[model samples]
Target: MRENLAPVSSQNMAFTDCTKPTDLSTEKKRKNWRNRIGFLLKTNSSESTLHIMKNRSCRPTADDVNQWAQSLDTLLSHKYGKAAFCVFLKSEFCEENIEFWTACEDFRTHTSHKELVSKANSMYEEFIKSEAPKEINLDFHTKNAIVQSLHEPTATSFQSAQRKVYSLMENNSYPRFIHSDLYKELCDAARREGKHIKS
Candidate 1:
């Protein structure tokens, strides 16, 4: 007895192996695999690899600092925001001002806060003398002293001096001119204030 076998046609074979439209999940999976392979091939290319290496090696430049300064200024103008004047002052004017330098030092030496205040006071006086005609107002001087003091209210003499200056400035009765060509008068005042507070 012989058994008859049907021949497989090209169309039948193709239909048997071909995926159906209903099998969308498998098609999606295949597409994802192709995409991953393409990405890998692109990253392995010489140009792409070089670009990645170059980006990693780049360093910050002066332009970066300028941009950062501009950003800081913008942030500072916002109300109740995380703005800092100290940062601006340090970045912009600290290098040019001696008083700022002394204040920074005073900040680090908590024990010598009074001395620092005193030193700042003196420096302001000197600054006024050197930059004469643009006299240092009593309020400015008092503020400098207070900043240097770091919130420390020292001896009676120091307190008295600060009070006197404050009173004069507040009353707007302080003398506008200095006599006897007193050089380093501001420095002297700062030094005396520091000494009195420290003692």
Candidate 2:
């Protein structure tokens, strides 16, 4: 039996299990969380109204898991690998980097001027402002440049900051991720998958 969990907090958002479709309070909180994350996604079902996370359970071969070790980009480009990495980051309480990074990526795909402006503003308040919730570390110059761009928001507004975050992850979290137990467990599972494939 699933129990209602205590409210969990991210850097700026609060989340709890999507208990049911009719739980207005719970639904409301989750909706806010999803909106703050800048990606409101839907799951296939009528019994749910708010869901932001995706199922990250994917079977990987040894080669697939090993490929992730090639580089941070390799891991992030693979859907499952990125999902798994998010979980790892969450465990370390440093998921904001990934969240901000992904939000910026999604920001670029928006075609509407109005939508772009709205997202850019929120992105600034959420991740770029000094001491903003979920703020990623950026140099003084980079942050200043982004603040200036907010006046006439463009698709590339977050590019420089995003690159900085990517570099930080590549040099820091990524090295630790490669050595994390989560990665090791996956590697062990993948090895079994490889052997099973042979059988």
Per TM-score, the best of the predicted structures is 2
The 10-residue segment of model 2 with minimum total lDDT is 1-10
Where model 2 places Cα greater than 4 Å from the true spot, the runs are 1-58
Residue 141 CA displacement from its true place in model 1, Å:
8.9
Q: Model 1 clash pairs? A: 117-148, 118-194, 121-190, 122-190, 125-186
* Global fold similarity of model 2 (TM-score): 0.69
lDDT of 2 by residue, 1-199 (tens): 1111111122222121111234445345434433432221223453422221222233445788899999999999887688777866665557888999999999999988899889999998898765588766666667778878887889999999898788878887888889976677667766764564467
**Collision pairs in model 2:** none
Measured over all alpha carbons after superposition, the RMSD of each candidate to the real structure, in angstroms, is 37.8, 13.0
State each model's CA lDDT, in order: 0.32, 0.68
Candidate 1 versus truth, CA RMSD in Å, comes to 37.8
Q: Residues 60-163, candidate 1, lDDT per residue (tens digit)?
A: 22232223234433322332111122222222222222233233334345446566556545544443232333222233343345445544534321343334
